[model samples]
Target: MKKVIIIGAGLAGSYLATQLPQNYDITIITKASAQDSNSMLAQGGIAASLDPGDNPASHEADTLAAGQHRNKVAAVDQLVHEGPKLIQTLIKQGMPFDHQANGALDFGLEGAHSHHRILHAKGDRTGLALTTFVQSQIEHVHWQENTTAVELLVKNGTCYGVRVRHDPTGTFKTLTADAVVLATGGLGNLFPLTTNDATITGDGIAIAARAGAKMADMAFMQFHPTLLSLHGKCFGLISEAVRGAGAILVDENNTPIMAAVPKKDLAPRDVVARHLTWWRAAGHQTFLDISAIPDFPKRFPGITANLDRHHVPFRTTNRIPIQPGAHFMMGGVQADLAAQTSIKRLFAIGEVACNGVHGANRLASNSLLDCLVSAEEATKVIAALEPAVTPALPQDPTTIVPPKLPSLADLRQAAWHNLGVERTKAQLHDFHTWLAQFNYRDLVPTQLSPKDFTIANLCLCAELIDTAALKEPKSIGAHYIKEVAHESTAS
Candidate 1:
């Protein structure tokens, strides 16, 4: 049997494990339990051309427009075209999707969606529902929890396996496989305020880069326009679906903030985030006015529960204190439609793979569909690959450590200030200098603790993002570089 090791236990990995052929031995390695994934925290629904009035062509056009026409045409085409069939398959297989009183599938709307093609389950708990459903179907796969992959095992330009450490016990082990797939999610944890799960510390991307895997679109990090923020700390995400339900961004005085911007509250995520960044920087508190949306609590029970836990009274007051927070990364190891990366026998799926579907900015609810579609595509190629001999492990000394290590809080703070929503050349240079203090790029230490490894990975990912941001000076999509205005002196 061909052994396959899949990193990450999110929707992509779980779904891929269930779809692979019987000849392949699948093993999933996760940093935490199966539930500790960004997929579980995703409040938005899956986007697909499921509605009678909607079609793949319309979906593709909306995706391209949201991506600023920078998306790979073929990749976008494949994602939209294949999405409906996959959704139908999931539905036929007993996936519980939200339905109207008439027993028809209830299609929701999100920003940039021209049609109500977004599918949800259990109200705002779509991700949780989908993740649990896919995980239930996974069988015949070895599960390794609390295992962090420190490095990818590559020999002669082909990835063969991974070196892992049981995070709690710190026991190291090397697992060799015929094929390795990275289903790890995005790098939202690089910033202080984020909507990402705790396990999403950019480990997969850093490990891939250190393994000499090609990366792409490293600069595009999407900030959600409205995360429930209390005193600058993120409480939780307020899904864009709320905005689609007639909520508007407003100031403390109940004045609409998006009134001047085209599309108003329904503008693309990057555009809305940019506005919120400037608005907050100008010392104004922003809020989401949800008074117009009928039956708020009944429609968004998950959000209502979160607000109740945080003691935010949504029923009496129709406003939600909001701020832009790091939500998703639109970049990672470069992969094709087949989910094949630059390295042979190695694949990247889900948020870890920049397959050009979400070019500059991701369309709302498209990420979940991307995960399922990519996993399906990857299963086909992985099942076809012939088994190969396990490559010999490297004999080099594995104790290379960085000279300087900053505290996790310090690193996150720096990332938030410099690489957050509005980035400038000065900010990028400052962040680059802060990252340069830790000469960790060249040193791939294999003996550090999981916490130390997380720090190192964050540093390396930060440097890559900084470098990419510096390379592209022009503003487009999510990578908005603000120009520092120079005051004219009396000359």
Candidate 2:
């Protein structure tokens, strides 16, 4: 039987695994416990055009607008057109979406959107709910939790499989297959302060880029404006839906600062995040005040509960301090509409793949939709290929040993310092120079290690991010240039 290996057991990988033919021997490698991913951390709902008054065109329009017109039109069209069907599939698989009195889907709205088209589950745990449901339904799939894919085992321009390390056993193993799918999530964790899970260190993008896949738009990152401010560091995310639901962004004086913006509380994420950053730099504390919101508990129980856990009571608290945190990467492994990368026998999906559906910035809640649609599309493409003869698995040589690499924490700090939030030509140029001088020769050991692979990927991703940021002189989306005196200066 032909085998398929999937890296990362997050929403995209898990869903894609389930969609593949049961006859194929499938193995899913997860870096940590199966649930440790940005997908599970997503509290906001998935955007879908299921409303009678809404359609794919509106969804596409909103996504394009949020992406700053840099999104790939064809890819966005496919995602929007296929969104409703995927939502139905998830619903049919026992996803408990919020329902109206008549048993219809209860939709919510977010910024840069013209329609109330986001679908949620109980309160704000839609992603968790969907992931749980998908996990339960995956009957025949083999899951290797706590396993990390260290490198793509490619030879002669075709990907054969991966070298992985099983964390629990501390044993390295080769998992070969007919195809490989890269679903590892975004690079948000590269920043010191982000809402993403710690495992999101741009692993998939880095691996693919090193394996010769084209990368796009690495410069565009999306910062969520309302990450909850904690005493020492920000941890929890304050959902944008709070603003969509009438909560206001106010300064220390409790006056709404976004009141004059055209979209008011409904501006795109980049606009809001930039505004919040500016507010903080000007010696003002930004707050999201939802105390006056009626039935706030029932409406945003997830956010309320999370805040309460942190000893901040949202029900009575008049103001919650806010700041922009590195949230989403708008760039990733370059892929076509079918999720096919430049390399043969490899596919990229979810936040790891720059399908261009998101462009320079992703629309709120459109992420989950991209996962579902792209998984289905990629699976279909994978299914159409005739199975190539199983090449003899590459033998591991006793003489070969894997290279030693930097610790994850060190890499995280390095990336965050140089590439977080804002940039400058000189900073990027210096970063490029420093990166060139860094010794990657130490990364090549005779044998491969997962940590080694992860570090290698991190360096590659950092380089790509720096290179892209330097190339795109104009500040757009989440990319801001501090040294640019005027917006027109770059143009």
Candidate 3:
């Protein structure tokens, strides 16, 4: 049997492991605990065309609209069409979704959606509930936690395996496999203040890019408009679903700023984020006010509990201060609908693969749905491939110790200053130059440490983002250019 080594034990990797033929030897590697992924922090429900009155066509239209005409029509169609079936599979695998009195799945609304087709579990803890359920059922798969993949092992233009750093053993090892799937999630943590987990540092995207895989649309990063600003290593996310449920974006004086926009509170995330940015620059603090919402606790129990744990009462506080933070990357290892990358034996899914389903901007709740549909499709493709000869594992060196690399704090600062919610041609050009200099001068060639590998990957991914953003002259979606006089005048 051919062995498949999956990197990043998030929803895509874990769910893909289950779908692959059990006969294949599958090992999932995670940087932290199994649940330590951005997926677990996803409070909004999965977007699915499950309602009897709704269908894939409607979902596809909404997704394309949000993507600003940059999404591939066929990819969007496949994702929307495959979404409900995958949701059903999750339900069968013990994912408990909210149900109405008649035993039908209860749906919630989010920004840019034409229908209330988002399926949730327990108010707003859908991602946690789903992750918990999936982990419980995935008993047969081999799990290597506290391990990070440093580089791809490619030979003769084909991917063979991975070079990994096992933190617990304090050593490097090579894991050979017939096939490798990189599901390592987005680069949100690259910024100083983001809703993404600390582990989301673009490892998969960087490793694959270095291995010669083609990346696309990397400039189109999504900045979520409402992450809670807290002082520390951890911060909380205020769900965009709150806006979908009638919450208002207000300035310091509590005046509604987004009321003039189409869909009002339900406008796409880019519009909402820009409004907040403008307000903040105009010497006013911005916040999302959900105080007037009648069923606030019932609709968002997870958020309420999280806020209560921090001693902030939702009912008493009139507004929650927020700003745009890096939330999702719409581009990554360019892939087809089957999740197969340019490389023959390599595949990518979830946030790491730019399957063209999201285009320039992702619709709310579409991320979880993308994970399900792409994972299912990729599993089928991987199962059909012929097994290849396993390559020999790389040996760990004992003679020399690798030098220390920059801290996560340094990386966050660099990314935020250059690649956050807004951009400019001059800033991006300078960033690219700095990155090229760092790579050529600082990074060592051999005996690389985990931190060294991670920082290198981050620099590569950041360069791609900066390069792509510099090329795209228009302000669209979550990506905005400060110097552009008008969005129409750009590009």
Q: How close is candidate 2 to the true structure, as a TM-score?
A: 0.93
- What digit string (tens of lDDT, one per residue) describes model 2 on residues 194-304? 898989888888777756788999998888888988764786798888887888999878879788777887788777777777777788888898866788778888887
Q: lDDT rank, highest first?
A: 1, 3, 2
Per-residue C-alpha lDDT of model 3 across residues 1-491, encoded as one tens digit per residue: 86899998888888888788878899999999898999898898899998999998999989988998789898999899888888887788678999988999898889889999988888898888877777776756889999888778877668888888888786777788878999899988678778888799898998888778999999998988888754433357889888877888887777898877777777888877777777777887777898767888888898888877876655777577677788999999999999999987899999999999998899999998888888889988888888887555344445665444456577668778788777777888887776665642244324665567667677778888998898887777656788876342111
Q: Which stretches of candidate 3 lie over 4 Å from their true place?
A: 231-234, 391-407, 440-446, 485-491
Best by lDDT: 1
**Model 1 lDDT at residue 252:** 88
For model 1, how does the per-residue alpha-carbon lDDT over 1-491 read when each residue is reduced to its tens digit? Answer: 88999999999999899889866788999999999998998876999888888899999998988887778999999999998899999999999999999998999999888899999999999999999999999888999999999899899999889999887887888898988999999998988999999999999999999999999999989999999999779988999999988999998888899898778898899989988888878889999999998799999999999999999877788999999999999999999999999999999999999999998889999999999989999988987888877756785465666546788999999998888888899889988877877866766547676677888899999998999989975877888887843211100
What are the Cα lDDT values of the candidates?
0.89, 0.81, 0.82
Clash statistics: count for each candidate:
0, 4, 0
Which residue pairs come into collision in candidate 2? Answer: 401-446, 401-447, 402-447, 403-445
Clashing pairs in 3: none
- Model 1: how far is 294 from its true place, Å? 2.8
Model 2, residue 71: distance off in Å is 0.9
Task: List candidate 1 stretches off by more than 4 Å.
Answer: 396-403, 484-491
lDDT-wise, the better of 1 and 3 is: 1
